[model samples]
Target: MPGRGAGRVLCVSEFVRNVRLWFAPQEIREEGGTPDYRFSLANERTFLAWLRTALALIGGGFAVDQFLPDLRWAWRAGLALALLAAGVLCALRAVNHWVRTERAMRRGEDLPVSRFPALLSLVVAVVAVAMVVVVLTGWEG
Candidate 1:
């Protein structure tokens, strides 16, 4: 708290150091319970992984819909809309999932996984495949 810092708050680094001091033991135990940093980081990584997946889906969908020569207007629109929805859903789920995971980890328990991601991914995949089919079929009618 020295230097030229008048009221610089404790950033993550400071907070982490303080947490380390407060729970100095190799394993944090609280009245017959243990706090797990590994679990917290694992959950964080999972959320990050999901977000990355969402971004990739968005990028892939847009690239195909906008830049691909074979994409018809209808197909492109459908794919783009689906991808956009998926991306928004992913962002919403990421925050909620992270909070749920953090809460569970803090209490040293497991929470039920939501099935919405799998269901949404399935719907998105179907839309993507449909787009590809439409592009390939070349409007037989």
Candidate 2:
């Protein structure tokens, strides 16, 4: 029974260590070198900003789905779903971008470029135009 208890404790300890490693602050991978703390902080800030954008998009989707009036069921559903999906996609991309940037910094490589800003702008523009048309034409169902 004592051996069994010790084994259980060891398993739990290993699990906790794995969790810590998964969520720990970014580590320097380069031998005997670390990236500038300021740059790392900036990267973290950018990641947080992207997360905030994702949250806003999700909230907007909920608002459209629950509050918007004078829209057909299909229109509302489509727009809301698109927004929510985009939000989730943005969040996933943010994590990838953060990791890539951090790694590039550690390796002294050029940071990867992203076209998401342009794509997001285009999507928002298209949605805005559609909303305007629907409102101006009084196309309520």
Give the clashing residue pairs of candidate 2, or none: none
After superposition, which runs of candidate 1 have C-alpha atoms over 4 Å from their true positions?
1-34, 139-141
TM-score of each: 0.66, 0.74
Under the 3 Å rule for N, CA and C atoms, how many clashes does model 1 have?
0
Which residue segments of model 2 deviate by more than 4 Å?
1-32
Q: Which residue pairs collide, candidate 1?
A: none
Locate the minimum summed-lDDT window of 10 residues in model 2. 24-33
- Candidate achieving the largest lDDT: 2
Alpha carbon lDDT of each predicted model: 0.67, 0.79
Candidate 2 lDDT at 4 equals 98
Steric collisions counted per model? 0, 0
Number of the top candidate by TM-score? 2
